[model samples]
Structures are given as structure tokens and as C-alpha cells.
Target: MTEYLLYYWPGIPGRGEYVRLVLAEGGADWIDVEREGAPDGEPALSDILSDTSRHHLPFAPPFLKHGEVVLAQTALICDYLGGRLSLAPEGKKDRRFALQLALTIADLVAEAHDIHHPVAAALYYEDQKQAAARAAETFRDTRIPKFLGYFEQVLKANPDSQDWLVGETRSHADLALAHTVDGLTYALPNAMEAALEDHRRVRDLSRRVRALPAIAEYLDSDRRQAFSEHGIFRHYPELDA
Candidate 1:
């Protein structure tokens, strides 16, 4: 059995949600360290980071410790777990396709986060309301479709099948696609619905991922955090056109 330890701020999903989705999909047992409900705060986070005694010190949250190996970056985590759990493709070309899909997911995730904090991530939304408003408009009108369209194209061009992003089997990219759709819908319901008709592949992938037993259960359970203003995908009526 492979042991997995996940270090992330538990309250808001944020980037941590990506790791959670992958772990859940893979049915891997992992610890969500530094959770709000946990005993300590910065001390625990710091302790985890400061323990230079351990060979693996991740640079950031959403980092995973599998056995003796520790890895950072959500895409790398996904790829690592995909290989460990056989969630990725077997062929080299197909693996590269999976990696490319992960990269695309990372791009969209960053853009989604910037929708609320356009100028700087360190600054609060209130501090940069004007900039956020402008950024939100740009994201709503331009960024969303451009990224979604690219995924749609990937789905269309996949020679193996149109159901999944890379190979005929479901990969980590498929899971990322589901999360992206969910996040977009929560953040911009009208935009998602309006754009849904245009991106059939994405819509289909969303539906398929939701139909998965574990994903469906997770969506209904408290383990899955809801999107809110405090989260990356914030719902600001003013931000929406």
C-alpha cells in the first residue's frame, strides 16, 4: 500500500482542490495537513516545512508525500499519482498528451484565480476592486472561451476517442476538466451556460466525470468545499457583466 501525505490549507479549496480531486479519483489514502479543524496553525505548517531532516521539502502547498518521495506543483503531483495509480496512458505519446493537458489545466486554474485578484495575489479583492472588475470583464469575455476552446479542440482532435482528453481510458486530464467546469459554473453560471452550447466536448466531459461514483459521492459530501468569495473562484455580482 502506498502512503500519501497532502499538505494544504483546508478551509478554502483554492489550488489544493486539484490535489484532492486526484487523490479522491485514485482512491488513495492521504492526510490533509494544516486543516482549520486541526490542532495547530502556522506552527504545524511551519513544522512540516522546516523539518529539513526530511529529504523532501515541498516548495508550496498542494504538495504530496508518497512514501519517501515528496513532490510539489499540482500538475506534477497529478502526473506522479497518475503513474503510480495507473491513471495515465501507457504509450510515450499518450503520456505527453496527458502532461500537455495538465499544463492546460494549470493555465486555466491560474486565470480563474486571477479573475478575483488581477493585480496581485497578495492583495485583497477589496483593495483591488477596480482592477478586479476590469480583469473579470476580460476573463469573462475573452479568457474563458479561448481556454475552453483549446480544450474543445483537443477533444475533437484526439484520434483515440472523443470521450476522454488523451487516450481511450480516463486520465488525470479528464478529472481536471471536470474541476474546471465545476469551478467555472460556480464562479460564472451564466457564462458557463451560455458557453456550454458552444463547447460540446467540455460539457460532455463534465457530465461523464460527475457520473463517476467516487466523484459523485465527493460532490455530495462535506469533504468537497463549496466555492465562495474567500475562495479562488469568487462570486461577485459586480465582477460579472
Candidate 2:
């Protein structure tokens, strides 16, 4: 059996959730290293960066150590795993479309992160609460609609003969869309509800993806992490209208 070692902060969903969704959907065997807050959590992220002894240092958490290969970047990791899991399309255009979908997900993920820390990633959410409040409004009122609209178009235009983002069967991109929708709903329920009213395909896609056996099982299991204050998508009632 093949094994994958995924190193990520066990607590926060962050970017790690993207990789996790793919692994769960593929039913891939993997370890979630640092599986929650530790009393001495591997000497803080900065300390780990200072140390060079660690083999194959990843630029960040959510890096996958697949035997000798070390892969980073959420989308790249998904693309690599997609090929390994035969989730990628065999056709040239279909494969390209899959990559495009992944890129779009990345864009949305960044935007979501910005919602809580709009002014700067360096500043803590507490420090920038005022800015984040304003930013979240813009995101809810303008940004989420625009980004999800793009995804809506992709699914509607879906060059292939399927309901998924690419190819006929579900791909990493489809899983990604589901995860994004789930995260947004958890973080900004009001905004998510408003956004869904316009994008029927994305809303339907999210529901269908959640109904998948493995995903349904994962959601029910203790292994699935819940959204919290420290995560990328945070529940700020003030931000929601």
C-alpha cells in the first residue's frame, strides 16, 4: 500500500484543508503529522525554519512527503496527487482545464484568507479587526460573488460531458470547490447563503460532493477538523450582515 506523510498544523484548517479534501476523496492513506496543538509543538514555526537538519524542508506546512519526493504548494500538491490517483483527465484539453480550476481555487483561497487579515498577513486578526471588518464587507458584497461566479461559469461551460469542473468524473478541482463552499458557509454563513442564491451550480455541486461516501464518512468522523477562530475562515458575526 502507498503511504503519504502530510505535515500541517493539526488545529487550523488553513491551506491544509485543500490537500486533506483530495486525500479523503481519493481514499488515500496518509498521516496528518502534528495532528493538533502540542504542549511543545515542534518548536514553533519560526524555530523550525531556523533549523536546517530537517530533511527536505518545505516552505510551509501542508507539504506532502511521498517517500523521497517532497511536494509543496497546495495546488501543485493536488495536481501531483490527481495524476497519481488517476483523477486527471486523459485528454489534453481536459487536463488543462483541471489545472485552470486548481489555479482559480488558489485565488479564492487567498481571498478568503484576506478576509480576516485584509491589511496584512503580518498583522494578527485581533490587531486588524477594524480593517478586517471593512474588508469582509467588501469580500461578502463584491469579491465572493465575483470569484464564485467564475466557478459557476466554468461548471456551466464545462467543455466535457459531465457535471464536474473537469472531465466526466470528479476531479481535485471539484473537491476543491466543495471545500471552499463548506469553509465559507462555516465562516460567513450569511454571505455564503446570499452568494449561493445566485450560483445554483456551485451550490448543487457542493451538496453532491458532500454526499460522496468517503466525504460523508469523513464529515461524520472525528478525523474531520471543525472550523475555529484560528482557521482561515473565522466566524465573525459583525462581518456577516
lDDT tens string, model 2, 70-185?
A: 77888889888888887677788787778888888889888888888888888888999998888888988898999889988888887664478877888888988898998899
User: Model 1: which residue pairs collide?
Assistant: none
Candidate 1 local lDDT, 76-106, one digit each (tens): 8898888877788889889988988898889
Steric clash count of candidate 2: 0
lDDT of the candidates, in the order given: 0.81, 0.81
How does each model score on TM-score? Answer: 0.91, 0.89
Off by over 4 Å in 1: 36-44, 52-56
TM-score for model 2? Answer: 0.89
> What is candidate 1's CA lDDT for residue 133?
84
lDDT of 2: 0.81
